[model samples]
Target chain A: MDKYILGKYVPLNTFIHRLDPRMKILSMILLMVAIFMPFPSWTFTFVMSGFNALIIFVLMLISKVRLRDIIIQLRSIWFLLLVLMIINIFLPPNGSIHIIAQSGNFKLYAESFMQTGKVMLRLIEMFGVAMILTATTSPQELTFGFGWFIKPLKKIKFPVEEVSMTVSIALRFIPTLIEETNRIYKAQSSRGVDFKHGNLKMKFKGLIALIIPLFVSAFTMSDDLAFALEARGYNPKAERTSYRVLKWSTKDTIWIILITLFAAGIITISAMHLDLLRHFFPKIW
Target chain B: MQIEFKNLYFNYNNNSEFKVTVLKNINYLINKNNITAIVGKTGSGKSTLTELINYFLKPTSGQVITDGFISENSTKLKFKVVNKLRKKIGYLFQFSENQLFEDTVIKDVSFGVKNFYPKDDGYEQKSKEALRLVGLDESFDSRSPFDLSGGEKKRVAIAGVIAYKPDLLILDEPTAGLDAQGKKEIMDLFKKIHETGVQIILITHDMNVVLEYADEMIVLDNGSIQKYGSPKEILKENVEKYNLETPHIYKTINALKEKGIVLNNVTDIPSLVTELKKHG
Candidate 1:
């Protein structure tokens, strides 16, 4: 289940893999809105994970990638951020920077392990800038960068090219539904359906016998990919004209002026609540 | 039963950097209660050599032995020894009538006889005697294998892999997209489940269903094994230089052995119409 390395791509050509897929989808939606516009500020999460670790080390050295393939795509969502930081570091809250413990009636806090280690470092910097904008954009340049961000909302007529062809066929079927759920979980685990040592009611009946043949082979491959996108003449209100235009150079205006001066230096250092960068990232709170 | 495949090299991303090599440097030796077949054409590697006998793809390097169970790679076979060697290998799969998800045809032929005989006790009379051995009896058990048809959903997916009895079945293109009477009624219910001795293998491009039910053929192209033998000595030579295509009753018995008229064991079309009625 090599979990389709999340939105795959990886063809590597460098320089954030030649940017401007609408400036890497508007610098990954302004770096996931400046990593969830800070609120719990432990010196605003160590200066926003040290400016997202220098933008994940210059987008993994300009998309040559490999920091163990972005820690194997952020270790597939680290088991829901390690069960939400182990239920917020063993159930916190009644604070005063706690942990002056008494033994039996626990207490711990330290502001819930510095607020779940600053929400797991803002979820590993929003899953490493969405896996470096899907390993440097290519699914038809991320469907022409979400059809150039919904082409000016098609002048209010909307249906913006059928919502960018249903978001590029749901991001090209997330690696064809992870290779048809890894071939219907290797054809129902070659019909024995053990699915990794059962028992949770036989692993929920081997996950509904591998999700009813992965929803009957994903509704029989989306009805043969909707009759092969209606036998090719796919007219989502026609007039579609793109071969691969997107140019806007000057290195996409210096990546929109360094993501608008790093979102105005993270909203002016979270509105000046910088007690000297809280005496240098005072263990994140 | 005997499967072997020693220096077998199958590679599909052997730790990436675009690996691919799908079964090159391979070798053979199938021998165990007959049948074989395996022709080629569509990206050769005949369904990656029937998923390396039943590891469902492993050999990115070597070994696969089988009926003495060796394995060697594909993570040295575990998961209860590949579900007890997939309950003795019943494979099927290439449009195995879309691996039916069950909802009937007697719970999809007792879903692999209750996943490899879970405490037996006549698993509903062995899933209605494997749906009456693929002809589909017991009034099509409680219908709805998506309401049958395309050759009764490939005989309820070959009675759900021979109702888990498998002594080695490996099918693949079991009469793909049928219709010459659904490919002679699923090759006469796989020649009555290979006369109950089981050991089948099949995988075809249909050199007339490997000259009417192969007793060993192989062929494969790019990823190696160009000819392994005995479909009347690999369809009697110049089989279009191994791209294949001889079976039109082996080009009318090689145009009546180029007029000299020798028909020694004519392979099919009713054994070349009973050897041209002994030369009329």
Candidate 2:
């Protein structure tokens, strides 16, 4: 369970890794918005989502994160995507524009198939976007970037510093907590607590044994941490120094320019679509 | 029951980049009816070795033939097979008290019994019997396991495993984190349990525990065995070469021998006192 690298930050020296985390965070938000831009034309929406999927793949490669690793990470969510596509393809609640296959009461539509493809592409792009952002940006960087991005919210007493500290601390303890849980799980399993072999009630009852210990340990750990922080004269409201401050470099500016151009292209294409792809590629069609 | 490891090789996260071999080419036959100790430094695959016997971890390439069940990476060790193995072999993890979860001592102790044999109606009886064996009486039964002293909580955890009455018990650092009194009591409890004819496999860093309790010992330096023989043989021969800690008793005996007062190797302080009186 600890070996799952999908959401983990992989430290690598790459072009994307060196980009300002705040810029990366900003681009992530922008790209996510672009992915779900809700264009009036379905063709433009479908095609643009496909294009975004390609962009994610290219970005992953450029960031030095292996395509294979990303695909392996995506495999865990493949079932959900499959279920969605299957329902969209075979059990669409409404009429089909082009019914390609039909049984007595069931029909398969080309339009619904296209719709399923669109859904799959959108989901894949979103997952990819998250993967790229997390894999490139370290947890510390992400926390700092998030805090910086939401700094304006502090004007309304939103406690951005506490939020960032909480994020950083949580990220730090994930590994430690994972190791503890594994130990408890193995210990319980040795005593014949089969977590995999039980009804919901039975499983929950079995889990109570582990949950109590985990809660106790977590409280103990947090208490110690708080004690240590206090002993060291740490304060949330007091301004703290950073070890690695985020700087807006020329690379960050170049990424912003690229993001602007991409956004502009998407806006322009979404504004004017009528049989666009086939119109451009009649021979291929 | 017999455990035979034939060319056993084990690794962690085999499909991931973090994959590293933990145990390599382990071959041994563990005959029944005696306590066998596995002594090794931290990360020397001591716990991992015990984990294999319990089928908590399986070998990458070789067979772990325990009580006639074979585990290897080439074939999937089925759940039913592993469940049967677990029933026959009880494992006491280090700091086992952390596993206590039930509100009452009896409930906590009976957790394993009830978990494995839900159909059995006499789990409370077995749990009570286990608690008695571990030196906890009926007075402590209804109290919350959480509120118990450290030693009492550890016993409750030990009782959880003992309630099932496993034929083979595997203890990983059973004496860890206990006071001297708690340690002796817990060790004595194991001795009493051992007298009942259940074979035991102990993983301990304390050489005194091995010298006093273990009939045979496997001195592990890394993933490989430095010496696999009686504790006496290992202590006499390769122990110093492997840099294993000489037990306090062994150190005292050695110091006496240097003063030209040679005596029989007594494992514990009480035995050494008796041996000294006999010679005097």
Candidate 3:
């Protein structure tokens, strides 16, 4: 199994890894908001691109993780990229006069192509930022961040700690579960169950043989885990002291300020519709 | 019934880069109604040997020929044949927790029986009888299997298999991670079950259990049979040869042997105790 594809966060003492998960999560949300807020003639796009490049460079240098490794993680979604491109080329645009090309009965419009490029770039940027956050943060840190983020919901008696623990365990076991699924799949295949050779219906039914054993193993593991947890007297409601404190230092503050400013700059540029920037920039459309 | 493995070889993941050869060119026989103990160092193909007998794994080469069915020669094992074999051959997993999947203890025990005999009116009755045989009360039938203690869970797992009335019972490390009392209870339960004419095969690392209960023992090393003989003969002669420890009672016998205190019929604790009293 490709470890990176399953979000198995490689531990390293990199700058991105050092930043608090709460800050990383907040930055991810701000970046997504900036992407969707619209840009003025792709100038904001260049600014965001430079920002993403800076983060990626710092992460790669600090974490000592290869750039090729991150690319491998992104490769799983190559089909999604192709689908987005196809949808963009065929989608009808409102008030579009220019036809880029015609194939068979389909007319490719200019505006739709431009929109598709913007959407694809946005998708890449969003997921790229998300990958950085998840790959750098440990499951414990993420769970703690969840608890801190959802502190306001405590007034409603929401089981925030319990939910965070559940999320953490689920994230921790995803790789294990995937490995188990692969084992079971291989076992069934050895039994002369040709999963790949069958028609759609046959393939679907063949999946049953795999699913039943996987589910059986999962339920059994859950039972053992529950027993282990109970034996340790794990109380979700107990007040606990954390080993790692999430504190905001000068470097952390600077990182947050820079990210916030870049987000604000994108929004401001988009809202103002600055014509000088538009004229100077290349037409990404 | 006899199961003979002739030059059987098995690898868990045969095609992958990380393939592990668990059992290698193994040849052995499990005779009918005999209590055979399979002993080996960790990962010495003990569990794999038992799994091969029930066709849980297909041998890479050679054949495993049981009385009525021949697994190695068969092209594919049908569900009917597998289910039929399973009904007569019960396998108790090392971690008994994996064996209990139903809501309550009784339901978990009855799962195998219900699956094998869905329409039988005596299914529940048989489940209760199996539980009682394992020294579990009828009231435990409604208790959640998850809520039971480790020893209780093991008993329930045993009851689950016994409810199917299997002729051959194979246990994988049945006394693992249990207290002395828990271990004694489990060994006693095995004795009771064996007395009912079920052939028993125990895979274990504990030498004490082998001395106490097993009639025949086989030592496995690196996927091959190191030695196979009766417990007393294996312990008295070849245990140290395989770099295996003899049981404490046998160790005492060895100490007495150095002092020229020869005693006959000193295999078990009771006989040893009687011999010591005579010497005094």
The most accurate candidate by TM-score is 2
lDDT of 3 at A214: 71
- Which numbered prediction scores highest in DockQ against the true structure? 2
Chain B fold agreement for model 3, TM-score: 0.93
- Tell me the TM-score of chain B in each candidate: 0.36, 0.93, 0.93
List ranges where model 2 is wrong by over 4 Å.
A11-15, A38-47, A64-96, A101-108, A272-279, A282-285, B236-243, B253-280
Worst 10 residues of 3 chain A by lDDT: A185-194
* Candidate 3 wrongly placed segments (more than 4 Å): A1-285, B238-243, B258-264, B277-280
- Model 2, A146-244: lDDT tens digits are 989899998999988899899999999988888888889988888777788768987787688678888878887999999999999987889877788
The residue-by-residue lDDT of candidate 3 on A41-86, one tens digit each, is 4445556555655665564566554556556755877787778767
DockQ for every prediction shown? 0.17, 0.66, 0.07
Instruction: Give the runs in model 1 whose Cα sits over 4 Å from its true position.
Output: A2-9, A15-41, A57-110, A122-188, A196-285, B1-40, B44-119, B122-170, B173-190, B194-202, B205-209, B214-243, B255-280
List clashing residue pairs in candidate 2: none
- Over B19-91, each residue of candidate 1 has an lDDT whose tens digit, in order, gives 7786787778786698888887888788887787777777877887888777757465568877888888888
lDDT of 2 by residue, B1-280 (tens): 7999999888887876568788888999997688999988888898998898888887888999999988888767676778888999889988787878778999888888887788999999999999998889989999998788888888888899989999999999999988788788888889999999889999998887888888999877668876788887676543656657877777888889899888775766888899999889
Superposed by TM-score, candidate 1 places the C-alpha of residue B245 at a distance from the truth, in angstroms, of: 2.7
lDDT of 1 by residue, A1-285 (tens): 455565578886877778778888787787777777754545456666677768766776777655566567667778877777678767774433657555687766677767667777776666677778888888878888778877898888888778777877877777777677676677667878787786777667778777776788778788998999889877678786776688889978987888878877776766776555556666863
